[model samples]
Target: MLFSESIRIAVTALLSNKLRSILTMLGIIIGVGAVIVMISIGMGVRQNVTNSIASLGSNMIIVTPGSTNQGGVRSAAGSSQKLKLDDADAIKKKIKNIDYVAPTVNSSYQIVNGNMNWNSSVYGVTPEYLNIRDLTVSSGSFVTQSDLNSRNRVAVIGTTVATNLFDAANPVGKNIRINNQPYKVIGVLESKGQSSMGTDQDDMVLIPLTTAQERLLGITYIKSINIQVSSADKIDMVQQQIEELLRQRHHLVGDKEDDFTVRNLTSLMETMTSTTTMLTLFLGSIAAISLLVGGIGIMNIMMVSVTERTREIGIRKALGATFRNIMMQFLIESIVIGVIGGLLGIACGISISLIISKFTQFNTVLTAAPTIISFAFSVGIGLFFGIYPARKAARLDPIEALRYE
Candidate 1:
């Protein structure tokens, strides 16, 4: 028989038992939908991570004090107070590829502006800190070199602090108290929603390094140093030079680890991306298991279909229907079920993904690749599972089939 004629016959037989056909295709529908949703979730998470890392800064490197080991006990990283302000100055004077370096120390404090008060992070920073952190002044100016040199009690506030302390009033030139000492607000930084680490960026205060060290915290060591490379290509070289120079300055000899940690944000981002990609593939693979289960369901139903139509098959054989024709007819029926189920599954997956994204914190991203792969996989499943049943039906003996009622 012609392929078109076989297809027409197969579709007609399936339509005659609409409910059964639908029930048989339920597995495929659920499997495809699940795969799509799972893959979308994985892709969305990966994208979020990438965006978060990008938001930190471009071509940035962070240096922090390393662990302290004394009397056979080693403390955690950043626990030691080995990083000095001189170290920051030395790196700046020596490093050629470095664009800006900002040495900083921070602590949380309750800020009071009249009766309105809020607890916020306070940082000791220089004018260069603004450029390294990509911070912009919405009003007034950032801490100047003169402010740092003279240890002036000037402050720059974030949007969160500004709103909580001053409300609708402009924060510039306003006086705010930190650690019970009055500080004049010199600038208000533009809002930076959140960091990759999930901390609110716009909830801190900035003061000159000299003022914070002498008048507030009263400590000599710095907590960390932030370095921005002049260009992307120079990040590795700059990081290496900084490490080597720091090691020499700290007087670390052979086999002795340095007392500081230098981190490259670019490398950190690449590592994060690789990890997320692996996670996405793993999720996709897990969801694909349902497709295999759905295929098995198709095979079982097709076998039952062949058994129920034994007498009809005998009649067709008696009427000069070739073995290939019988096999093709049954196979086409299975394929139709698969194709229809797959289309429905695609719709189901997309609708559910959209709903989850809208109603929940999860942001799902749908791509054409997963949808296409799922449909094709479902069709392939139908063909692979239908083969044995179609062959069994085509091989039945006409004489015996007719006598068996």
Candidate 2:
């Protein structure tokens, strides 16, 4: 028979057993759908983290006091008192690559503006904190050197805080109380949404580091040190130089343990990307097992089909059909089932990824490559599993098949 005639025959046979064909493709459908969903989530998570890191600035370097690791258990990033305000001042005075430095501290307290009250986090940093956090003020102005030097009890509020505390009223020059300590609002920072770590950035208060250390927390040790480099191109040199400087300052000799660690956000981001990508690939492979099961389902159904059509095959051979024609017809039928299932799987995967991106804050992108690969994989599965059944059907003896019926 011609190829078209063979296709017609194959399609007719598949249509005759629609319910069986659909049941057979179920495995492929589930497998492909699962693989797509897992990959989508993994990609979304990676993208979210990348965006969060980007918002923090590539030139930003975070310094926290403490040992990093020992015996697979890590101490807190900023648990020790090795990082002092003097170290921060030293870096500012000495480091050429460093453009800005801010010793940081934090506390959570109920902030009240007249009758309105809400609990919020208070960040203690110097005037240079804006450069370190990659922040800009939307109204009024940032904390200046004068404010820090004079230990001004002025605050820069986030957009959410701006809305909450002042309502429709302008927040500049207004007084807000943090744990009943009054601070004049000097500025309102632009909104930063939520970070990858799930912290709301638009709900904090900012105060001078000196005031926070003396009046509020009453501690000389800074929890963190934020530094802004002049340029990202100088990051590696800056990181190395800072490490060497800190080691020397901390009195580290030979293999003696250093008390401080410098965290380069760019390096951290690269590690996160590499780790997430590998994990996503692993998860994708695990999901591909379902596709294999689906392929097996096709083979199982094909085997059943060959058994049912034994008499028909014998009669067709008696009526002049060749073995090759029978094989092609059956193979085409199997492939068609796979193609249909694959298309459906692609559709389902795309829809799900879009829904995730829209409803949640993560970035779930459905690119063309994965969709094409998924469908192609489904079709390939059909070809790999269909050959055996097709060959077996083609090898059947006309005389034996005829006599058996």
Candidate 3:
């Protein structure tokens, strides 16, 4: 028989038993759908992490106070008052390949603007903080050197704070009280959206570091120092230089643990990427188990199909149908089931992924590569599982098969 005739026969046979065929294809459909959804979610999570790190700024490094040991009880990181504004200045002056340095201290405070009141983080920082964090003033002017020098009570507010306090107002040249001390709002920052950790990036205020240390918080030490490198290639070098400089300044001799921690964003990004990639692979693997189970279902169903059609097979063989033709017929039937099921699974997976992204916080990403691969894998599953049943049907002795009842 011709190949097309075999395919026609196979399709006819499946159509004759529509319900059984659909039930047999169900496993493949579910397996393929699950795989696509899992992969999409994994990729989405990885992308979110990458974007979150990128939002911190390009070619950036952060310095913070390390843990301290007093009376053999180690305090939490950043609890020691070691990082200072002077240290920030020293790093800016001494370190090469540096673009900007922003030393900052932050505390939560209840901000009052007349009858309206809101709680938000208030950060004390220099003008460079804006450039370092890739933030721009959307309204009015940012803090100037004059503001730092005079310890002015001027502030820059984020978009979230502006909305809560000013309510669609420009917020510039307005007065807001922090801890009962009235301060002028000099600027409003553009929205930065939310971070991977679900932090609202646009929900805080910025003020001059000197003003915060001298008047507001009354603390001399800064909580953290953010540095922006001039180029990507120089980030590691600059980080090393800053670490050595800090160690020397703090008088840390050999084998002594430093009082500060230096971290480059590049290393952090790499670590996060590797971790997320592994997570994605793990999720994909777990979902692939369903495909294996689906393949087993196909084999079992094909075995039963061959048994039910024993008399028909004997008739065809006695009527001069070759073994190759009988085998091809069965194989084509299984492959058709897989192909149709795979297509349906792809559509279902994409639809569900889109629905999840629309309804939940999770961001789902769909790409062509995974979809194509999954479809191909389903087809392979069909071929592999169909082999045993197809061979068994083709090898049946015509005389005995005719008497199978």
Two-way lDDT contest, 2 vs 3, winner? 3
The runs of at least 3 residues in candidate 3 whose Cα sits more than 4 Å from the true structure, single-residue gaps closed, are 68-75
Q: Give candidate 2's total backbone clashes.
A: 0
- For model 2 the local lDDT of residue 283 reads 78
lDDT of 2 at 323: 86
Task: Score every model by TM-score.
Answer: 0.93, 0.93, 0.96
- Give the total clashing residue pairs for model 1: 0
Model 2, range 172-246, lDDT digits (tens) per residue? Answer: 999999877899999999888888757788999999988888888889889988888989899888888888888
Q: Candidate 3's residue-wise lDDT over 37-132, tens digit each?
A: 998999999899998889889999999997656778877778889888889999999888888999999999999899998899999999898888
| Alpha carbon lDDT at 112, candidate 1 | 99
Name model 2 segments beyond 4 Å from true.
68-74, 360-363
lDDT of each: 0.91, 0.86, 0.91
